[model samples]
Target: MNVVSKIEAAAPAAAVEAPAERMRRVVAVAVEHGDAVDREGRFPAETVEALKRERLLSVAIPAEYGGEGLGTAAVADLIAQLAQACGSSAMIYAMHQIKTSSFVMHGTGSEWHRAYMRRIAAEQLLMASATTEAGIGGNLRNSICAIEVEDGRFRLTKEAIVISYGNYADAILATARRAPDAASSDQIMVVIPNDANRTIDRTVVWDTLGMRGTCSDGFHLEAVGNAAQIFPKPFSEIAAQSMLASSHIYWAATWFGIAADAFNRAQAFVKAAARKQTDGTLPPGALRLAEAAAKLQEMKGHLMAAIHRFDAAQVDAARGDDAALSSIGFAAEINALKVAASEKAGEVVRIALLVNGILGYKNGTPFSVGRHLRDTASAPVMISNDRILSNTATLLLMSRFDTSLGG
Candidate 1:
């Protein structure tokens, strides 16, 4: 069926206008202003401000802490919807949510952490990740800096490869060696609220092909906080349970949003073409649109399946280094989904571009898909799909799953 037919026969829209309704309104603002944000390489501050007004920044935090207390799947839906309007805004939001969820996941037994969570909920404070280091080569599991302690106070300094929207964040959640004498891989996470002597010092410029509104520039972060600010839990657990897992899920959602936008555009083009013809024939480009739609459906299924699996495992609330998740092969499967979703999202956008032909290549037109095309191009390389596949290759070699019917 064509677009109009689908809508006429469509299932009922929500009676009360669900939270996604608010997100869609935020998306409309993003779609209106996204071009300016991308062209000037400026942060989507206005779009972000609108989302904050909607209290979306705290959408995933627990209710006891004054947030919406939504689940990972729900948060993923929000980000995907946001991406349909503005890729930069969605990604920036995704990173902030991932960091805040990290704060919630592994931070325990510390009164400071509890207070901080309440403060984040109250303030709707945006969070930034200073995880990627200058020399870590994108390995979040390793960090070269160490926290130095004197009396009950601790200090840390790190050369961050990129801190997305660093200037706008109220605080940064960063990783460091567990102690001055700890190994590079033995890391601890601590929050450095934006305060005196604790601002992110920009060391490099940010100019990129797409997702430019993120303002992801290099920075040198230095800060001092009470030793109690440090999470008692290991960084490994935080990364495994919250950072990596949650980020992958949310990232895939936004990617889907971008692709969905492209697919919608393509659908409009095909619908118009059909309307112009008396026979209501399928346009030559209709097949490409079909492929894009199929890929999008596949992407959503793959992502949500893995997400619900994690939820069922209750692994997000599991304590300690979370070595059990890896032992049971959940980590490997999640990584595989990340790889597949990233690659497939890009493909969907590419097919949509093909369906739209030269119009999609143009900028600033109703049918123009340049922004969606550009943003989707960055999907696969954001976390380096090659690295993920390489890691999963080892799992494939040493482990196997039962594929028998009804087994």
Candidate 2:
């Protein structure tokens, strides 16, 4: 029998708080734990725990599975809002949403996946992805590991160069060569549940300058499961439709949130100084604040325009339609969004630091912009802007010109 045909209700029977209320509480926990998670390079366990308890982790799953069934915009808003409190926490959340898209889009009508989705909604289990391989050099399309099948069961051992919050994840969605002897680019996404019968071997140490709480480091992942554990669809469709666009949207949203924090701080600093003057003279940095605000608006416009374009397809925006998603132009635009968000986030942090003078540089204070500056500085280099530009160059070559939008 197929996994989807097994048995059970479409949605779970469990009850939980509303998503916004749940997120507010989780953000508070993340804010409380943010400092220590960064300073000591530890995981944001408190935030993760709150997320589980509040059942907000399943917000990305379909409501039929007893989840919130939130759309892409709502998910983006949630991620960006959380980022204002903690970058690592938001990054972890963003990854979970990205992984969820895979199952949400492809798992439909599958008996095994339906049950798994029910489990996720009821248990609030977090997911981590091991798509990046050391040999592939950050390319999600290439995999050095291959799955071996025997007796209706399969086993694969993958080297994950960076599995963010790996230690805390309840399941992993991994990519690998389709078969033992398949080409590296012929890949499939496999679901490996972190259950008692399955085992994963990992020893990763992450100590970074910023976004320290993510604890994203190397891991040796090994697991065995029924062949049904593999998604029925190919990874390419998953990538073009959901993975690529969702990743860019969620990630860029979080970066925008980070920049928003810095902008708010800068504006507040200027306002406070302006209030102290008897003559009501505006502070010098007030002009700088306005300039940063303008830049921020532009940044948001670029990101949102791309998001709306994707939304225009009118099919389940997250799952994505083939013809709309396959357009080289759309792909190029998505890549450009990543570049803009990453670079603009860094610039906003710098503006915040400039406005607050020594106070923004100080640590352990509400007025301090040190942490924001540190984390935002790493954004542009996370996926490496150079790589994005190189890939976009090839796509732009064949893209058509629309004179209206800077053709």
For TM-score, the strongest prediction is 2
In the range 1-407, model 2's lDDT, one tens digit per residue, is 53223212322322344567668888999888888888988888899877776667888788888688887888888888899989989999999999998888778857888888888877677899889887886788888899888998989898888888887888989999999889988899989888864565566677778888888888888888898888888888788877888888889988898889889888888888988878877887888898899889988898788778777642744454467777787788888899988888888889889999888899876678888888887787777889889889988788874457641
Off by over 4 Å in 2: 1-18, 314-321, 405-407
Weakest lDDT window of 10 consecutive positions for candidate 2: 5-14
The candidate scoring highest on lDDT is: 2
lDDT of 1: 0.81
User: In candidate 2, which residue pairs clash?
Assistant: 3-111, 3-112, 4-110, 4-111, 4-112
Per-candidate TM-scores read 0.91, 0.92
Candidate 1 local Cα displacement, residue 242, angstroms: 1.9
Lowest lDDT sum, 10 consecutive residues, model 1, at 7-16
